[model samples]
Target: MKNIKIKYATTFTIVVLMFANVSAQNKSELLLQSKISGVIKKMALEEKIAMLHGNALFSSGGVKRLNIPELTSDDGPLGVREEIKRFDWNSANWTTDSATFLPNGSAIAATWNPEMANKYGVVLGQEANARKKIVMLSPAFNICRMPLCGRTYEYYSEDPFLNAQLAVQSVKGIQSQHVAACIKHFAANNQEIDRGEINALIDQRALREIYLPAFKAAVQKGSAYTIMSAYNKVNGYWCSENDFLLNQVLKKEWGFKGIVMSDWGGTHHTAEAANNGLDIEMGSSGPYDQWYFAKPLLEAVKAGKVSEKMIDDKVRRILWVMYHTSMSTGHPAGSIATEAHGKAAYDIASESIVLLKNEGNLLPLKTDKIKSIAVIGDNAIRTFASGGYGAGVKARYEVTALAGIKARFGKTADIRFAQGYKANYKASNSDEQNAGYDKPDRVLIADAVALAKTADVAILCIGSNREYESEGHDRKSLELPFGEQALVNAVTAVNTNTIIVIMAGAPYDLNEIKKSCHAIVWSWFNGSEAGNALADMLAGDINPSGRLPFTFPATLHDSPAFALNTYPGKERTTEYKEGILVGYRWYDTKKIDPLYCFGYGLSYTRFTYSGISTDRKTYKTGDKIDVMFKVKNDGKIQGKETVQLYVSKVKSSVSRPEKELKAFKKVLIAPTKTATIRISINVNDLAYFSEKQNKWIVEPGDYKILAASSSKDIRQVAEIKVMR
Candidate 1:
């Protein structure tokens, strides 16, 4: 009896401590809120209004008398950009500002590992802190609706789940350093053509299922502190002042407590914007005081055109974010261009190189037998670290493919180089400026052929550069630009032991290459360590594991948007007629064959999938569906494999896609060893947004669960029933 009494007393003490901790945290939060309220109350109308607009190019006004420093932001989704002048677009040219250039968004997504995304965020946050930036304007994850979209390299996959998974981790990782991550181009800002004026006509179901998941997850789950409104219009409203999007869905439904800033002159109106949802106006033209949220807002408030309470709310949110960021205690002093940062860049780039075709097993080049290597192409030597329309980093150093190859194999083999093509592109040039740049240069091609004929092996690097695939304009076609097809044919006809390395962000015309080339590799505009990572992969130091984030259609016409003739829309309005059937969904449902399906990739080592099952044959709503499978390394060397799980409804009253990706895991295994893998999916995740009900509805029915290597490479399947 005495022992039992002692045990009860201990339990009571533990409970008391838990409650005390909660109370203390609550008190701290209340104190912060009280302080914020006091600051807001003390500010005059003009002072509060001043805080709502930009005072310079990359900063907004703050209360100097109250010790509130100006909130500064830097462009990202690559790395911290170089410092620019206060009042102009010219570079500040500070030698100390050079930073680490991380891999682009598509490269990270190709890794198919959310851990890499987290690492990327960590690097970004640290660098931002080092620059004393309040907000890191990054993680621009717009959906890749069309392959021709110039910003496809900057966005994630076509799948909402994949985008959501990466976005949540990226946000958490950035915020982990107490630096605010600003998620950008909110809602249907897919294409670059007419971005500021184009109206994206999207239905509610498609918006919920396809376009907005990543931003939603970033806000609700990752707790992002700032959002950048897109330059486009959704339906009939500009995103900067869209009431349904900002006020209703984001603020009320998702409970986002962050400030919404304009995307550099993306603001349209003064009164409408202030009343609708905009909190900060940035990058508008003319005098700072004349900006939409500057003097106009003050006048609107005094005339009762906009409420003073609304101004208080905006100030309160900004102050709240400030406390969490610049004013936060214990914020780490960030580092840039360090060896650790470079290694992080290398890790992502190494895994991002996808082996597309290896008909003769020509890769992992046997260095012992090779006497000379013919390295050809302009991309082999071109540095993509800086030249692009959107955000680009002033890299401390960028190792080109040629540099990496020479560093790796110069000791043993004689390496020769030839510029097979010229990247005749400049950001200032118009689309039609270099009209004949795509035509083959006879002299360059002949020189490349002559070099290839003499060497035992040839490494042909060919693809689009940053200028070809950029932010202001989409590509005219997926054809290998700069007459690369002719160059490839010429070089391949001489050297049968040639390895083709195509580097670009989005899918391109690979039909001819697939037919003629025995070996092919797909690379990206990867960052500073790109060449080093590529050399390691070719030398067999690291196995190729990156997967394709989106589907590669056989031709431009094979894609849904182009096939439906709905792209670039007629009269500045484009309707998403494809709806939820995007990427693999469109291909699978329509019985169309893609050149390469979503999540498709090849590795030197092989892995086989078997023994697929579920924990239960039946489950209720909110129950977890546990899926079990086994993957064995069937090759002689160890390799990493990304196991994908897709779910399909067997029978439904409404129309649905054939299947959808729910969860995935990347695992490494030793040669001849099998690893058992288990992935759990919430039954609620199986539901689709119903247009009729305007909410998600999980129907009671049997669903087919598929375990696969890729979207089209399903290996095992099982059935389970969901009860009401």
Candidate 2:
């Protein structure tokens, strides 16, 4: 009782101080408010339409005779999309940055690494600041509804708890640099079919329970600075103008203070969009909005249908971001061509890769034993083939796998190359592969295998193309694109010493490769310097430190969430049966074994975990526990290991994931060196949504904390009781 009183008093005092300050600043707030009011007052129909007129990435009021400041904006979670000379918004120029895609949110959640996600944030922030972008349309927090559905690449795993935790960190990272991070696809944007017009028929419980929690987590913990509304309508209402979602749920309920922007070309009706909580209508020739806001909005205020306070609220939010983004001070985002910064982009790219399989010690090939090597695959030579979507900026130079390997080996190694597969095997970019970020396929994979037969080691690059694993669509299955699966089997059949490098952007099932191949390396679209990064890692010049971002299901059938979809459901649609059991959670909860569970990855070397610690006999409200562990890289090369942590809700009233990732930390240790990792978990970390309590309530009973190198590999467990 006493503690609660103290807390309430402190909060009350703070609120009082804030209210008083606002009241005192009424004159200043009023002056700023009047600035908006004058614009509202004079907004004639034509002048209003002019206000809605947009530059490619921002907006301006063409009442230029009356001196109007242009409102500036930019591209999403990555950075600014400036229309530079030769940089046309209509035509993409390949641009590579220090930015690397952290596994989709789902895969990131599987790692359960908050600190690591925060590190990703730091890297993102540095790049966003460097690029002078005001808003990043990233840290996508949409719920994964069904499998066989495209665009899952844009979301984290299906679990809301996991998604929320990682998103908070990513958001914090971008904001740390000044620009706002957008947690997007507001309300259920589960599928991409007719995305702009699809109605997300959602029930309130589903919204509050599954789709909304991730947003709640980010808003509450990370203080996400911006939200991008989805293209779809929820419960028959457009996301941009959905009052229940934007105003009532996001603002009134969650206290979200960030700006709300429409997904590019997502806004439908201009007046309704602005009338709701939307602050900016992104990426449109929005003259309609200018007229709507100027004349209609002014009328709304005059007729008392809406308050001027709302307009001031929207514009104030925009100004707050503009002043904070501070575009003037930082160096302008330069072209990667002829620049030193481009080197850093490749460095980060190399570091982001996670090695999934190494069998029969096929990796770190002996430099001397390799008399001949065969590099075969369509993506092996195609620049920007693996890297897809968004801004596909071409480089002044590109390093192909064949070229990089040859350069690395020089006189010591004789390397032969073949087009293992055509990036577009169909000879046309019209099939499923060609339509998305598709690469040519293995119509010529046979010849590559022919070369594979005589070589001491045949490196087979078979996985996905840009069309299959990009921002516009989600992969239909966890299998490698085209007939790459068959190519892997056939190549390995002809040549036993084949090393398959899966150049993909998402987790793919490789049961055949896993069984037959000597080794497998997962390269999630390594950018401009992809070839060099792979060569360096393969040559032992750099240790492979990337970890799996998402789970590699044994088979598409093993995926619990999607299996229930019954695609083209009985009603000729789908079902989200296993609601929250997305990714490995479903497998773990139901005790199904996946081909490769979440957090599954291997290092060139090896690691062992020991010495787990948590200094507590019991946890109560406001309690925190410190956990310490040791990771020893027992291999010949010095390596970095990510210590993953997970928490489980025991005996929940509602069914729950067996374990939920709460925290994670990354530590680098020299070969034969033991590094200690200390991770802290708050009592709230073990909390669960209690149906009885109707809130996210922490149960006062027992808790188990597990420390492991990966999800399935639990190295230690400690038991603690929570007291009320």
Best by lDDT: 1
Cα displacement (Å) at residue 636, model 2: 3.0
Report the Cα lDDT for candidate 2: 0.65
Q: Which ranges of candidate 1 are over 4 A from the true structure?
A: 1-27
Provide the clash count, candidate 1. Answer: 0
Kindly list the per-residue Cα lDDT of model 2 for residues 1-724, writing each as its tens digit.
9999999999999977876777655655556555656765664444443444244444434455544445444443322333343213453333543333233343344344565466556655665566555566677767665544555554666656557777888888777777668788797777665667766555454566678888988888888877888987877788988988899889889988677878777776655776777766665443444444545565666777766566656755654455445432453342323334345445655665667677778788788888888888776776542244543333345576777788887578778888765554332234554553333344566677788888888888776655555555555567566567666777788888888887754566778777777788876555456678788878778777766655667777777655664443333233556655666677888888877777777888888988777887687978897888788888888877877788775666556678877777767789898988887889976765554555666778777789977778898887778888
TM-score of model 1 vs. true structure: 0.96
lDDT of 1 by residue, 35-95 (tens): 9999998899888998999999999989999999899999989899999999987999899
Candidate 2: Cα lDDT at 433? 46
Clashing pairs in 1: none
Please list the Cα RMSD from the true structure of every candidate, rounded to 1 decimal place: 4.9, 6.6
